[model samples]
Target: MDAGTELEDHFRRVYAGNVEAILAYAVRRVEQPEDAADVVAEVFLVAWRRSRELPPDDEVRLWLYGVARRVLANHHRGGVRRERLGERLRQRLTAVTGGDPAGEVPERLAVRAALARLPQPDREVLMLTAWEGLQPREVAEVLGVSSAVVRTRLSRARARLRELAGDELTEPGHVLDVMTVPAPEEGR
Candidate 1:
């Protein structure tokens, strides 16, 4: 194949193979699915522009993940803006829910409140593995860390969540199970 045909094929294959995972990763990081789509678009645009410099498939996957990490960092730097917008959204939601948002169920509210109290990194680790259904290795790739590190973080995050939930949550594979649970629909 000529260079153009080769590039097109590469792009097609990469997009087909990685798009769903990338979008899922982005959704776990960002508040809006639209924002996640934008991040994915940016990642692919960079891949297209730098195709000449692209590595083989395995390395390209890592590179795309790095791009996503940077995109999330950029999003975080706009934290105040996002917070203000979130507050406005919360207000609107409260209004729609008739202002008694908890609505007679204290346990669910307590769980959500406890979740909110966890550190951001812990939450990210939990969301990446649980909600996104990524294996520890893949979670490490997204976090720009090693698999061992991901495993350690996952352990600690689950422990913290269990503590916050006021449950013993102690089982041989409980942490792994927690990490594999689907993410709640509200945030990601």
Candidate 2:
């Protein structure tokens, strides 16, 4: 294939394959679900612009992961971040305004609140394992750490989360699993 065709083909395959994975990564790191959408867009935009640098086959997913992690870091540094999430949240908010609230269960909210209290590093480790369903080695790839380091971090994160959650919320293997549950929809 010519360079243009080659890049097009690479973009299609990588975009389709890694979109959800990248989105999940962004959501785990970001404060809002809509920020996850901007993350997804920016990631793909970089891939499109730098298609020549993309790796072959499934490795492109890893490349996207690296890009997303940097994008999130840049955003945290107050560098050139956009409000893709703001627009989506506005739409979702408008749809639910002046309507009955659909509540997140009290327990789930508590768990989430406790999670939010954890240090960002600890939270990311827990989320990479629990929410993203990544193995320690795979997580190592995403976070640029050794597998042993990821495991150590995951263990510490889990303990911190459970401690923050307190005994009433304690349920082995399920403490951080609240991230797995979907929230209730409003005005649907």
Candidate 3:
């Protein structure tokens, strides 16, 4: 086979083998599934470009992990990142979920508000453990912290998130009002 054909074949096999794991990792890490998809796509794109020099089996998975981590970090780097990713995430989410993100809107708003109230580090800890499904040890690897520290932070962060959720959404007026459409007049 020609170099081009060989590379394509190799990449296809690698991609099929690892796509599910990579996708799961991304989805767990990101608040928006669309962002997870972008991360996965970027990881594979990098893999494709560097296909000729890739490592063996699980090494490829590890390399994709590293790439995904970097991609997520870059995606959250600054204010501009939010605006850019927000628009794309909204579009993609709407498309996939049938333009009726309405169902989860209140929950998302409440959680987002709660997360916004948290310190960045605390938020990251909570997100890694709860949203990303990372164990403390895995979280430490992702965050460059000790596992014990991750455990400590995760405890405090979870408690704080609980507190925030209670404080923000338990009141009668906290949610659902906006979702209720007004009835038409009986007689005008």
Candidate 4:
């Protein structure tokens, strides 16, 4: 197949299979859903640009994650730009709507705190599953490890979060709901 065709196919398969998980991973890192979408878009764009170098399907998902990590790092290094832009946007939106900028839900704040306390690998596993919605195997791919390792990490992460949250963390969807709140306009 031509390069364009091959790239399109790659995107079709990878995105269809893994976009939600990728977006979730981005959300955990960036703390803004819109920014997360941008990250995911950039990741796919990189995949398209380097399609010739992409590995087989089984590895493509993880490869995309590695790309996401790099994109996030670049974003961090350019932090002041995004912060200034966000501040300006927030000011404009508040003036237009006569409302405070949206804040994180309390539960989300707790979850964030708990997640922050987790070790890096544990946090990644939790985000990969809870936020990114990756299957254990897919998370393994993202982490470049075996599924068994992913499961172990996830179990440990979950335990740690539970310990941090105490009883409140036990409910289904509680953590996710806390982490994901409605956008300001969406609340209208």
CA lDDT scores, all candidates in order: 0.76, 0.78, 0.76, 0.80
Q: Where's the lowest-lDDT run of ten residues in candidate 4?
A: 179-188
> RMSD, each candidate, Å?
17.8, 17.8, 18.3, 18.7
- Encode model 2's per-residue lDDT on 1-111: one tens digit a residue: 787897798789888887888988999998878878987898898989888888887578887889998888877765333465566667666664435434436667777
TM-score of each: 0.42, 0.41, 0.42, 0.42
Ranking by TM-score: 3, 1, 4, 2
> Could you tell me the TM-score of candidate 4?
0.42
* Higher-lDDT candidate of 2 and 3: 2
- Any idea what lDDT model 3 has? 0.76
lDDT per residue, candidate 1, 59-99, as tens digits? 87888899888977887777768798899777666654564
Assess candidate 4 and give its lDDT: 0.80
- lDDT at residue 14 of model 4 (Cα atoms): 77
The stretch of ten residues in a row with the least summed lDDT in candidate 2 is 179-188
- The reply for model 4, stretches above 4 Å from the true place, is 1-3, 81-188
Can you write out model 3's per-residue Cα lDDT over 110-164, one digit (the tens) per residue? 7778777989998888777655566899999999989999989877876676677
Q: What global local distance difference test value does model 2 have?
A: 0.78
Two-way TM-score contest, 2 vs 3, winner? 3
The better-scoring model by TM-score among 1 and 2 is: 1
Which digits, one per residue and each the tens of the lDDT, describe model 4 over residues 1-188? 88689778867887788888889899999956788888989998888778778889898889888999999998777887878879877766675546543453566678899899999999998887876668999999989999999998888887778788657666875665565433343331
